[model samples]
Target: MSLKVLSALDVARIQLYHFKAIIIAGMGLFTDAYDLFCIPPIIKLIGRIYYVEEKQYRTTPTVVVSALVAIALLGTVVGQLVFGRLGDRIGRRSVYGLSLGIMVLSSIACGFSICRTRNCVLVSLGFFRFLLGVGIGGDYPLSATIMSEFANKKTRGAFIAAVFSMQGFGILVSSVVTMVVCKIFEATSHVSNGQIPEQVDIAWRLILMVGAIPAAMTYYWRMMMPETARYTALVEQNVLQAAMDMEKVLDIPMSQIAEDSLLPSYPPPSYPLLSKRFFRRHGYDLFSCAASWFLVDVVFYSSNLFQSQTYHRFIKDQPDVNAYELAFRVARFQAILAICSTIPGYWVTVYFIDRIGRVKIQMIGFFFMAMVYFAIGIPYKYFWSEKIGIGFITLYALTFFFCNFGPNTTTFIVPAELFPARFRSTCHGISGAVGKVGAIIGTVGFLWASRIPNNNGKPDPVRMTVALVFLGVVCLVGLAVTYFFTRETMGRSLEDNENDDE
Candidate 1:
C-alpha cells in the first residue's frame, strides 16, 4: 500500500465495472440532454397552449421564451457550484442520488404545470425547470470525477469522454421522442379545418414528463455506486476503505494493509483551494478550462436552443400545415442533424481522445469551429438564400459535429484530470458553472439579437450574421487560451498529472 506502488484499480484492465460506471454516469447526462433540448421543439406548443390572445394562440413572447430556456441554465450554475464543493467535502456517492431525485420530481412537476392563468403556468413551469436544471448541473462534475477516478489511466480520456458522449444520445433521443409524440397526436387527434387540436397540449406535457423516466430509472444504480477510491484514499486519508472499494469494483484481491502503515506514504497535505499556493499550481489550468467551457457553451447552447428558429426558414413555407405537423417537422429536422453530426462527433472523440491527447483535440475543435462560424457569418445572407439554404444547414450541422468532437468533450474531461483529487470535483464544478453562465448568455442573447423587430417573430438574417461573427471571435479566443494554457492529460495517471510525488 505504499504510495509509490500502483493500486490495483490503476493497473486493472478494461472490465465490466468500467462499462457499468459509464452507463450509470452516462445515463444522468442522457437525462440532462433530453430534458434541456426537448424544450425547443415544444416551446411553440407551450405558447400555443398558454398564450392564447383574442381566442387564438400566438407565438410566445421572446421574453417568455428566454425565461423558459434560460432558467434551468441559471439553476445549473447554482447546482454545479453547490454540489461540486459538496462532492469534495461530503463524498461523491453521498449526494449523487439526491440530484437525480430532484430531476425526477421537477420533471414530473413541469409536465403537470397546469394553472388558472398563463402567468401562473409560467411561474410553475419555470420554477420546476430551474430545479431540474440544478439536478442536471450536479451531474456534470460528479459523473466526470467518478468516471475519471474509476478508470485506468490508459483509457481514462475515452472513459470520461464516453460519459459525456451520452449527451449526444440524450439530444438525439429528445428529438426522436418529440417526433414520435407529435406523430401520434397528429394521427389520433381531430383537426377540424386544420386548427391545432386541444390534444396538442397533452403532447407537450408528455414530452416533458418523459425526461423523468430515464433519470428515475437510474437513481437506484447511482445510489448503489461506491465512492471513488481516489476520494477515499487521497482526500479522506482512508486507505483501508479505498483499497476495499477498489478490490470490490475491480474484482481483484487487494493486500490487507493496515491503515496507519500506509498513512505516512500518502502525499503531504497540499495548499488549500484558491489559496496563493493553490493558484500558483493550478491557476492557469483552471482559467483555461473555465474560459474554454464558457466560450464553447456561449455558441453551443445558443445554437441548440434556437436552431429551430434559425432553420425554420428553410422548411418550405408550408402555410397550410397544422401545429402538430409543424412540431413533427421541426423534431424530424433536429433528429436528422443529431444523427448526422452530433452523435457521430461524440463517438469519434471517444475513439481518438486517448490517442491524440486532450489539448490537441480541443484546439482542433476550437480552430475549426471558428472557421465554420466565420464562413457562415461572412456570407450569412447567401447561405440563407433559397438556392443555397442547404449549404447553410450543412455548415450549421458541422459546427455541432466539431463541437462534440472538440471542446465540448475535452472541457469536461480535462477538468477532472488536471487538478488534485481534493479539488478535482470543485474545479470541474466551477468550470461547468462558468459554462452554464455562458449558456445563459447564449440563450438570452441569441434570441433577442436575432429577432426581427417587425418580421412577425422571424430571425433576422443580418442580426444573425452579427451573432455568428461574435461567436466566431469567441471560438478564436478559446483556441488561444487552450493552446497557451491547457496542459495535456493523455497517457498519465491522475496522480502523475498532479505531481503527487512532489
Candidate 2:
C-alpha cells in the first residue's frame, strides 16, 4: 500500500467545507477569553469599591484570585466528564448545543451578581466561572472532533489547530474589550470620597454581559452544521433506525453507503470506559496527554497571568509618577502588548499550523520563549535598564507573542488530536483540568513572589528571575515530553482511529 501525506495547500481546501463549524466553535472561546480579561479589571474595580487602609488590605490575595480562576477550571473538570460521556452516548449534535446554552445562561446570571462581600463575590464568581468552564470544556471534544474528523488528511494538524487558534481571537478581543471598557468607566466615572463604586456597575457588569452574546448567536449555527460522518457511520450498523438517523444528519441516502461503512451494533446505550480494548491501548497516550496539558497550563497561565508584573518590574523606579496613574499605566500598557502578542500570534498560527506541524511549532515557540524569559530576567536582575525601560518591556512583549502562538496554542490543540472519539471529551477535560492545576501553582507562586521586596524597597530582581527561570525549565520539560510521546499528526485525520484494528 502507498502512504498518504498531505501538504499545506491541501489543508486549506479541505478545511473550507467545514469553515462554518470553525466560526461557531470560536463562540465559546470568545467567552472564555472575555471572562479571563474581564477579571483583572474587575479586580481593580472591586478593590476601589471595597478598599481598606493600606495596612488592612493585601491586594486581593493570590490565593483568592487563584481560587476564583481555578474554580472555573474546576467546573470544566467535572463538565468534561459529564458532557463528554453524555456526548458519546446521546450524540455530539445535541450535547454541543446544550453546553453553549449552559454558558449563556450562567454568564447572564453572573452579570446580575452583587459583589458586596468577598465571600459572596467569590462564591458567585466561582459558580459562574464553573458554568463557563463547563461550556468551554464541552467545546473541546466537539470542536476538536469536528475539525479533525472533517479536514482532508494532508493538513489535519494545521487545519484542526487553526480552528483552535480562534482562541487567540477570543483572548485578544477580551483584552481589547477590557481596555475599551476601562476607558469608558474612567471617562464617565463618578468618584465619591475617593472611591469608584458607581463605575463598577456600568463597566464590569457590562463586560460580563458581553459573554452572553456569542453563545446566543452561535446557537443557530450549531443547529445547522453537518454532523460528523464517522458518528453517522458508527450508528448505521445496528438497526435500520441507526442508519436512518445518520441519513438525517448527513443528508445522504443510506443506499449510497458502501455496506461496510456501518459498525456492528453494541449491546446497549453504552459500555464501561475500560471494557473496550481500545481504552486499554490508549492508557499511555492518555497519561502523556494529561501530563502535557498540566505542564502547558503551568507555563502558559503562569507567564500570562504575571504580565502585570513585567510592567511593574520594567517601570517600578520612575520617580515622578503618582500611584494611581502608575497603576492605570501598568494595566493599560500590559493590555496593549498582550493584544499585540495575542492577535498576531493567533493569525500566524492559523497561517502556519499545517505548514509547520503543531508539535514542531510549539517546540519552536517554547524555545524562543525560554530564551526571552531568561534574557529579561537575567538582564534585569544583574543589569536593570534605566535609560530605555522599554527594552525590558520589549522582551516581555516577545514572550507574550510566543505564548500566544506556541505552547499555549499547541496544548489546547494536542489533546483534541490524541484521543479517540469515545474518550476524547473526557480526556480533553482531564487534560485541561490538569492544566488548571498548573494555573493554581503559577498564580500562587507569583502572588507570593510579589510580596518579597528587595533591600531597595522594590520587587526583588532575584525573585522575579527565579520565578521566570523556573517557568522556562517547565517549558523545557514539556518539550521533552512532547518529543517522546506525541506522533506527528500533520497529515492524519481523526477518522484514522477507525482503522485501529488493522
lDDT of 1 by residue, 161-194 (tens): 9999998888888988998988888888867433
Off by over 4 Å in 2: 1-17, 54-59, 189-197, 235-280, 313-331, 384-388, 454-458, 497-499
Which pairs clash (backbone N, Cα, C closer than 3 Å) in model 2?
Answer: 6-154, 158-353, 158-354
- Give per-candidate clash totals: 0, 3
Which residue segments of model 1 deviate by more than 4 Å? 1-6, 256-260, 267-270, 316-319, 382-388, 453-457, 499-502
Model 1, position 461: C-alpha lDDT score = 69
RMSD of each: 2.2, 4.7
For every model shown, what is its TM-score relative to the native structure? Answer: 0.95, 0.83
Worst 10 residues of 2 by lDDT: 1-10
Task: Supply the TM-score for candidate 2.
Answer: 0.83
- Which model scores highest in lDDT? 1
* Clash-forming residue pairs, model 1: none
